[model samples]
Target: MFWLLFTLFMVACFSAGATGGLFPPGAWYRGLNKPVWTPPDWVFPVTWITLYICMSVAGARVALAEGNGIAMAFWSIQIALNALWTPVFFGLQKIRLGLAVIGALWVAVLLGMIALWEVDTLAGMLFAPYLLWVTIAAALNASVWKLNPEQAA
Candidate 1:
């Protein structure tokens, strides 16, 4: 049962991850002015792959736990926001909107982390790296928006 739940959660995470394939950051993103701290292109896929695994494991852990309603809700919210971001930012080329989406995602992840903690300690711990990654992603989004105000407009 736990393995089945884990697979389901992994499907959800990868489904959300599919957005990246659909809306890749091509020349437009390459041309944009990014901050010095921007992560190298190679880092994204590696980080996301690792994060998705962790997210799936955490979701699976909390799925059958008692009092997991809030955790599950937050999990759903975070995944939806996660899927929305790439389309908005890369597909639509709406940097400002992407910032908004990522900002909301950040909040959802933070809440999800806290809520997951309430249900299972290891589940909550799993989200810690995800939260950190999102924080970096949010900062990257904001920096991109700020650095290219003209493009964002």
Candidate 2:
């Protein structure tokens, strides 16, 4: 049951992550003036893979536990927001909207972490890296928006 739930959660994470393929960061993103801190292209997929595994473990732990309504809901929220950002930013080419979405994602991750921690310590521990990644992502998104004010519409 735990493995099944973990697989399900990983599927959800991958589903959300699929947006990257759907909307690859092509010429537009390449042309943008990114901060020096921007990670090399290779880092993204690797980072996401690690984060997803941790997230799946966290979610699986929470799901199998009884009375996990709030944690589950937060988990759901973070995933939804995660799925939304790529389409809005890379698909629609809305930098400002991406910032908003990523901002919300950060909050959802934080709240989700806290909520998950209340239920299980290991689950919360698993989520910690996700929050940190989102923080970095949010900063990156913000920096992009700042550097490319012309693209904010």
Candidate 3:
């Protein structure tokens, strides 16, 4: 049972990370005016992959622990929200909605982190990078929205 849950969670995390690339490729993001601190495009995949691995392991740890249903549910909710972000921002080109989704995602991540902390501190800490990344993404999304208010669909 633990292995099954772990595998499922890992698959889900990988799928969520892949959603970021759903956008039409090549310069699709480059043309947009980004914040000065936006890291190079290559940095994103590396960061996201690392974060996803951490999230998967954290989730698996929680699943293997005792009485972690609530934490698991919270993690699932946040991940679902995380998955929606790429589609909203890239697939549908809804920057404002994407910002809103990511904002909610941040809160969900915080809740998941807290829940994980109660069960296992390391699990919670594993989620930290994901939380930080999402927070930064939220800020960037807001900046994009502000800079391209007219561009929002």
Candidate 4:
């Protein structure tokens, strides 16, 4: 049951991550005047991979607990929002929309974290790093939007 639940959650994370492959940040992103705090290019994949593992483990733990209905729902919402941000931002070249999407993602992650905590402390703990990453991502998205008004959509 643990493996099965882990597989399902991992698949959900992987599906959301596939958007990155579909709409990669190419020359446009590279050319942007990013803030000094922007992370190096290599940081994204590594951070996401680690977050995915934590997210999947969190979900798996929650799935095993009783009365995890709300937590699971929040989990689904966060993953869906995660899948949307890439396409809207990179594919559509809409930095403003990206900010909105990421903002919602941040909220969903927060709610998911809280709800997961109620069900399983370990599951909630796993989301702490994910929330931190999303905080950074949201700041990055907002910074990019502010820095590149001409590119706003």
Candidate 5:
């Protein structure tokens, strides 16, 4: 049962991740003016893969907990937002809209982490890195939008 739940969560996370492949950051993103603090391109795949595994583990753990409705809901929200951002920013080149999506994602991740913590300590701990990564991603999205006001408009 635990393995099945984990697999289901993994599927969800990876499905969200697939959006990146579908809407890869090509020439447009490379041409954008990014902050000096922007992570190297290689860091993205590595970090996301790690985060996905952790998220899957967290979700699976929380799913089996006594009271996880809110946490699960938040998890679902975050993943959907996660899937939306790549297409908005990379595919449609809507940097401003991407920022909005990521901003909402940040809130959902934070609330989900807290909710998960209430149910299971390890599950919550698993989300810590995900929250941190999302913080960086949101800041990066905002920074990109600010630096490229022309594109943002």
Candidate 6:
């Protein structure tokens, strides 16, 4: 059961990380007017991988704890919101919608973190980076929306 659970956790993290590819090529990203402090493109994949792993570990911890069904449900919702952002922004090229989704994702992640905290502090801590990353992503998404108002929708 432990191995099965671990496998499921890994699959969730991997799938979420890889969802970036659902977007158009990085070329489209390059064309955007990014913030001055935007990290180099290569940094994104590595950061997201680490963040996703942390998120998965946190989620798995909550799942392993007693009476975590509600926590798990909220966590699942946050993950789904996370997964949808990349496609909405890059795939569909809907920056405004994506920004809105990302904002909601931030709130959902916070709710998930709170729920996980009830089960395990370490689980909540694991989501810290995830929360921070999404906060930054939200800002970036908003910046994109601002920079290209015409393409926002």
List model 3 lDDT by residue over 60-129, tens digit each.
Answer: 8898899898899999999899888888888888889988999999999999999998998999999998
lDDT of 3 at 116: 96
Per-residue lDDT, model 6, residue 58, is 82
Model 5 scores worst on lDDT over the 10 consecutive residues at 95-104
Clashing pairs in 3: none
lDDT of 4 by residue, 115-149 (tens): 99999999999999999999999999999988888
Candidate 6 Cα outliers beyond 4 Å, as residue runs? none
Candidate 3 segments whose C-alpha is farther than 4 A from its true place: 1-4, 24-28
> What order do you get sorting by lDDT, best first?
1, 2, 4, 5, 3, 6
Could you give candidate 1's per-residue lDDT for residues 4-93 as a string of tens digits? 999999999999999999999999999999999998989999999999999999999999899999999999999999999999999999
Clashes of 2: 0
Report the Cα lDDT for residue 145, model 6: 81
Candidate 4 Cα errors over 4 Å, as ranges: none
Q: Mark the 10 consecutive residues where model 1 has the least summed lDDT.
A: 37-46
Per-candidate TM-score against the hidden true structure: 0.98, 0.98, 0.92, 0.98, 0.98, 0.93
Error of 4 at 96 (Å): 0.5
Report the C-alpha displacement of residue 99, candidate 4, in angstroms: 0.5
Candidate achieving higher lDDT, 3 or 5 = 5
- Which of 3 and 6 is the better model by lDDT? 3
lDDT of 5: 0.93
- Model 6: how far residue 49 lies from native, Å: 1.2
TM-score, predicted candidate 2 vs. hidden true structure: 0.98
